[model samples]
Target: MNVLSRLWTIAAERRNELVSGVSRKTNAVEAVEDLAAQLKDVDAAVVLIFASPHFDKDKLADALTQNFGATPVIGCTTAGEITPLGYETGTLTGVAFPRLHFRFSSRLITNLSRFSIDDGLRFCREFVSDFGETPGWNSLAILLTDGMCRQEEALLSAMEPGLAPIPILGGSAGDGLDFKQTFVLHEGKFHSDAALLTLLATNFRFTELRFDHFLPTEQRMVVTDADPGRRLVREINAEPAAVEYARAVGCSVDELSPFVFATRPTLVRVGGKYHVRAIQKVEPDDGLSFLCAIDEGLVMTVGQAQDIVAHLDREFTGLKAKHGQPTLVLGFDCMLRRLESELLKKYNAVSELLRQNRVIGFSTYGEQYHGMHVNQTFVGVAFFDPENEEETGGEREK
Candidate 1:
């Protein structure tokens, strides 16, 4: 099999340039060095990395920082990587954006449990100080944190007031379902129990993308008992959470496993749209642990699967109609989607959709769109440059 593949790139004449590359080389240094070679002339403003957990993260971070220290280098470990061709494992993929069209700044947030609004405000202020206030510029914040922290809700909430006007888009890092350790890069070092914030301010047109393939059903259960801090639901409608959930999905309590949870996820309505609140596991107490935050009194409904390909196609179609042509799309996909596709025997079809759309990212533990931290969803940023645009814009960005 061809491990190293060609990059999917887009250029906006003299304004901005984006080039994405993937490397299957076993050595982290060689992999990144090979990927870096693809960008020759342009001085990158930021380099976004999505890498497998197989590498010594410190070495990878050090190597990438040494090579691209002048720019902001940020990324996180992933459950699985999305490349130009399709879904992959054990690979490091990245994209470099030229400085002319993009300006980048970042902060490494440590001790996620103690992450505060003050800290968020400080980070926002720092970003403003770097970029200055621009009236017509578009901005987005890329947030990556340890998947096991369970602090997304608190951290994201704190970040809201400070990051007004600049939307948030990102995902929680994963250790390939090992659930042991996950790493995020800041400058030239890798840190755990932390999060990295990358602020992107650009003159080019950018569209924020968030979509899912689950429709709510009539069945509903109220969270009578839950531990919001631990994201554990002890009871649903006053019954054992797993038991009630299994019954709703037409399965026995014993069959309430990861595969089942992925195939038949639960949804919670947020902002009038149903966002999936996926179950991570059936706890020892028969309680249900979720990938995202859940609270008592919250109503959860079972979700039915939609035609995954069709939903994706529709979203992409709409994007092209509006953006002209996407220069690059940085995606954050939930790992559960991969599992669900496998259960439905549509893994190939789903991978094809990612390739067809030139979506490069990783399957994450969870995703963030705007200010909301969610699960089983795909969130991304689609960039467009008018000067060298594609006339027949397909939904896929670079």
Candidate 2:
């Protein structure tokens, strides 16, 4: 569909109080202007943007500052965007929260390599203190970090304690599978080795959502050797990581690739639940690079893919039945999930579900659920009717 048609479709679906739009214009200035025009009617407290990495960062930043002028904009480059029309590429998609029902505050963390647990805890404490709290308002946080920084595990660990009781859901900024550089945009500019944490308070009823289409198998492997800091496994079951993994999945060493990894993911059990430890790439030395944390002696099982369409249908249906239809679902989806859907020939079905459910955000290298940085999963916040807040058990505390 054309850009205007897509915008009109979004307009028709949006709640008058919440604003969202997508722009296919390739020019950086035009893209921002298009978004600005769509959001013009809403007196937004903050605007969140998810953009294609192909845009020039400096130009995009300048245009955003000029167009939005002191409106507190925050966003990041995306692997791909989830638009009003569902999955899209080379597009700029955004959601503007009106000031009447929503209030926002943000902080930017730079130099992630030197960020310690203590630092993160302190930073989060200060942020929450400054944001304060309201008697009848519900609060949540959204984190956007450099996808390539490899620091999400540490950062989330530290901040969890300080921000306890305030739910968090987020995505790692992606560069279209480039793996070289990823950036987080805050305060009108993009920065590497950085993260943006935004605290939001709203009167609307909201709930956190998480789901993945994978089940663990009995077959397992041990990481006998690894570079824990870099999330690289050199040996699995005392054999070259890539070779052993390929054999386990019934594929030759030469056939090991991102697609293979996506189709056959590795899982680790934590707190009596399984979480995906997705493989990002096969290294030159036959090592396996993971998207989340990994360490020597960790036991990982080969995860089998389930029915993607049915799983999503069931989840969304349950959500609507329980909480009524969500006005908007701010989603953080893993890019690997998108790839696996294509591999399984379920891309269109998945996109249709996202569109029907009112999901808008970006595909990420990794996704954050509360304190955990997970992969091959969908994490989101579903906002429901403010008018029904009392019936929905007003103002969720956690």
Candidate 3:
């Protein structure tokens, strides 16, 4: 495969001044400086930065605002970053939208645990008020929420109905698998226990992307008992959740670990398509906790794996054919998919696909697409140029 792995490491500055870059510099200031240098010429309206959780976010936020200067900046900590250089840790990746291309506005939702459907409606109203009169242009919302908050489904469900036809895509923030804390940047500061929403009105042609390679098996489990607030399922078909799940997957109860849960995720059908509702972990009482919301009476099927590479190859090829070769794809891939890919020994193949497709993003704690907060799926925005078919700037590493 002709994979240009380190493409994001080389600052890409097109004639239109749309730039995206990744830096592995450990020093917060140095990393921000390097990213800022690539975007210096453009009047940046939106600067999305994803960084390692180890860096002091306060200091990093300071460095970013100092360089970008009050531009509507938003991003979050990540488990692992996806750059043009493939999967990486302890690095910062960013994309800057030049003023000519995008207009940015933001709203921060505080106390997500207390957030409700009403809050979603309110946020939508505020968004409309702030970015009034977005006509003849496409608008997309970028959401960065605390991955540990456990309220993604509710939040997205609430806000989505009101913001009709404006597609939303995002990832939950992570703390490098620690799961202790996560932060989102808004108005040049990092906030925990909150979600940052940014609305972008852009002139660029782009397509929303999401795909998974799991087929539903006949084995089904009904959620007989669950705590929707905590996303814990205590019973499946009136049996202990873990035990029943293991039985369905053809494994012993003792084998129910994070790795096993990741590999043997369950799926729920929505609109005739199966979406993964991945198991997060096994609880002390033998309950199973899920990455997204779970409720009683939900029918979930034991998902069987297919060729991950084959599925992705088709999705990417079809996207390129429909969109005529993307300039880039800002991807939000579910972490469980990464685990499943690694377990299936297809991690490198998946990475090469991402590199070849010019995907720059991170493995999310969860993925948001439209109204659904799904798991084990890859969601992204594929950017296309209406003016030219020639490939734009970005150093190619063979």
Best by TM-score: 2
Question: TM per model?
Answer: 0.91, 0.94, 0.91
lDDT of the candidates, in the order given: 0.82, 0.90, 0.83
Candidate 1 global TM-score: 0.91
Model 3 residue 361 distance off true place after TM-score fit, in angstroms = 1.4
For model 2, the superposed segments whose C-alpha errors exceed 4 Å read 1-16, 388-394
Candidate 1: pairs in clash: none
Error of 1 at 186 (Å): 0.8
lDDT of 1 by residue, 245-356 (tens): 9899998998777778876789999889999999988899899889898999999899988877788878888888866667677899999888777777888988987887
* Residue 51 displacement (Å), model 3: 1.1
Write the residue-wise lDDT of candidate 2 on 1-398 in tens digits.
99999998766545337777999999999999998898877778999999999999999999999999978889999999999889888998999897767889999999997879998999999899999987678899999999988999998998788898898889999999787799998999999999999999998888899999899998899999999889999999999999999999999889887778887899999989999999988899999999999999999999998888899999999999888899899999999988888888899999999999999999999999988999999999998768753432345512
- Off-target runs (Cα >4 Å) in candidate 3 are 1-15, 388-398
Rank order by TM-score, top first?
Answer: 2, 3, 1
Cα shift from native, residue 50, model 3 (Å): 0.8
**Candidate 3 lDDT over residue span 1-398, tens digit each:** 13464443233434255667888899999999888886676568788888889898988999998988866677999988888877778998988787766778888899988888886887787776768644545778888899999989888887787676677889999888788999998888899999988887766677888888888889998999999988999999999999899999888988777667776689999898889999988888999888887899999999887787899999999887766778788999887777777777888998999889988889889999988899989998887654532422211111
Candidate 1 residue-wise lDDT at 73: 77
Best model number under lDDT:
2
